[model samples]
Target: MLIRLIYASRAKSLGPMDVKDILESSRRNNTAAGVTGALCLSNGVFLQCLEGDRVVVNALYHRILLDPRHDNPAILDFEEIIHRQFGAWSMGLVSTVADNQALFLKYSTGAQFDPYQMRPQALRAFFTELMGNTRWLA
Candidate 1:
């Protein structure tokens, strides 16, 4: 069965090259595993959605949880889905190069980047908006 796993984590010292490296690595790994997702890094937080087989997505999430590049990893939404929202991407990414604060404010109530406080549907909506936004196109 297919599943969608959404999680948020604090961002580390993620520079341009670091973001590039992450995107490349994720693209490669996820493509091989038949996973597709979009990753958004904004205001010191990362919001990502992984869609694939339950076992593969679960394993990938576990590896992500162990990665030391970020901390405070929290799973926001995890459920079986009939279709992939991010089917066009192996691992599409949006980093903090743009105005992250504004982006966060656009989707959230406050200026702070506390995605864990958002309701599941709201978070998914935010992800959908981000995925469709031209600025976040990858």
Candidate 2:
């Protein structure tokens, strides 16, 4: 029983090394737990998607909920999936502080990437497109 979970949260101040550390930890832990996902950080906000067994994904999400680096974590979408959309990555990462103008425009209605304002399918579309376009951390 595979599932996909999408979530958004407000992040704390993060330097490049902090993001790298987070991604490395995620890659290591997710690999061990047989989970895959993508994480996007933009303007102190985080958008992430995780796919794997229901138990594994859910447990990972709960752990993310407890992490002090982010606040007000909210699950945006959760559903059973036929296949992994992010199968190639243990944990893919993107930061809007970089060159992601097109990505932001497509997903954001205004000048910011606020997942809370998006419709459900629109939110899912954003993640899907992100997974397809962005290079994952290796």
Candidate 3:
């Protein structure tokens, strides 16, 4: 069955190169694994949505828990889905650039983007709106 998993985690001292390496590896690895998703990084937090087969996505989430770069990982949403929302991307990166500030704030609870504080429906809406915006990194 198709499933979507949304999770948030605090970053543990990441540099530009580290983020680049993550995107590169995610694109390569996720494509091979038939997983697709979008990653949002803002305010030292990582909010990611992974969509694919149930078992594959679950295994991927477990692997994420083992990564040293992430701290305080929390799964915000998980459900069986009829279709993939991010079918075109193996792994898309959504950066908190200037142009996208308002978009991020719209769904955010406070001045910063914190998916952990957002309800599941709000997170889903945020991603849906994000997909329509052209400002994301990829």
Candidate 4:
């Protein structure tokens, strides 16, 4: 069955090139694993949505828990979906750059993007809107 998992985590230490390295590795690894998703990094928090097979995604999430770079990982949403929202890309990076500030604030509860404070439905809505409007990093 196809499943989508949304999770939030704080970054242990975000280096200047860390996000770049993450995108590269995620694109490469997720492509081979048949996973598609978008990763958003803002305000020292990582909000990511991963979609794929149930067992594969579950295993992937568990592996993420072991990664030292991420801290306090929390699953925000998980459900079976009829189709993938990010089918075109293996892994997409969403940035909180200047142009995307307003977009991010729309769903944010305060001045910063805090997915942990967002409800599951709000998180789902955020991603649904994000897929079409946000400027993605390469």
Candidate 5:
């Protein structure tokens, strides 16, 4: 079954080189594991959308959580979906670092604080952005 593992985390450092190295390993592992998705780093936050079977997705999720490169990780999105929204991306879409203004607007939602908190507004905005941008990984 196809599922998406969407997560965002605060980076330990904001250096571009640091971000590159941190993401490279995850990107390579996803490819090797036959997982398709996208990874985006912006404003010290690393966001990724991954797709694959139950085992691969779960394993990848666990690996990310344990990776100490990021601290106080927050999983912004995660759930089982009936369709694949990021079928085009090999690792789907890695977003560039968003500016402070953009980041503020993105996370300005009034949803609940918990990661697993289900809020329609926040979820809608995220998926809408992901769906609207066809060239996410470009």
Candidate 6:
């Protein structure tokens, strides 16, 4: 059955480029594993949603837990959503904002640097934005 999984993690203090490298690697690996999802990182927190067979989703989670860049990772949203915000990505698609701002919001712009407070609405908005950016073309 198709399942939707969402998880978040705190970064040790990775810069934008470092975050990009990690996300890029994840995208490549997730694609190879036949999983699909949208990923977002901001305020040192990562938000990701994976959709696929239960086995694949769980496997992906396991792999993430092994990554050193993250710590105290938490499963935020795991229920099945009625519809997918991302319909095109295969494996994964990742986006990052380097500040206290979110990927989604009234500003729709995020801080390029510095640690920002993690407000609930801003973070959620960012995750939603990541979902909205799903690559149907892929």
Give lDDT per model, in order. 0.83, 0.83, 0.91, 0.91, 0.60, 0.60
**Residue-wise C-alpha lDDT for candidate 6, range 69-124, written one tens digit per residue:** 77877776565556555556654435343332333344334444221333445545
lDDT (Cα, tens digit) per residue for candidate 5, span 1-138 = 777667767667456576566556656776687777666555455656677887889887887787767877666666777877666545544454342234334544433123234354565466556566434433
Using lDDT as the measure, name the better of candidate 4 and candidate 5: 4
Q: Write the per-residue lDDT of candidate 4 for residues 72-109, one digit (tens) a residue.
A: 99999999999999999898888889988888789899
Q: Per-prediction count of colliding residue pairs?
A: 0, 0, 0, 0, 10, 2
Model 1 agreement with the true structure over 1-138: per-residue lDDT tens digits = 999999999977667677778888999999999999988877678888999999999999999888778889989999989999989899987656554456566768676777878888988888777766636645
By TM-score, how accurate is candidate 2?
0.91
In order of appearance, the predictions have TM-scores of: 0.89, 0.91, 0.97, 0.96, 0.68, 0.64
Pairs with backbone N, CA or C atoms under 3 Å apart (clashes), candidate 4: none
lDDT: the better of candidates 2 and 6: 2
Report the Cα lDDT for candidate 5: 0.60
All-Cα superposition RMSD per candidate: 1.9, 1.6, 0.9, 0.9, 4.2, 5.4
Instruction: TM-score winner between 2 and 4, please give it.
Output: 4
> Which residue pairs in model 3 clash with each other?
none
Q: In model 3, how large is the Cα lDDT of residue 78?
A: 97
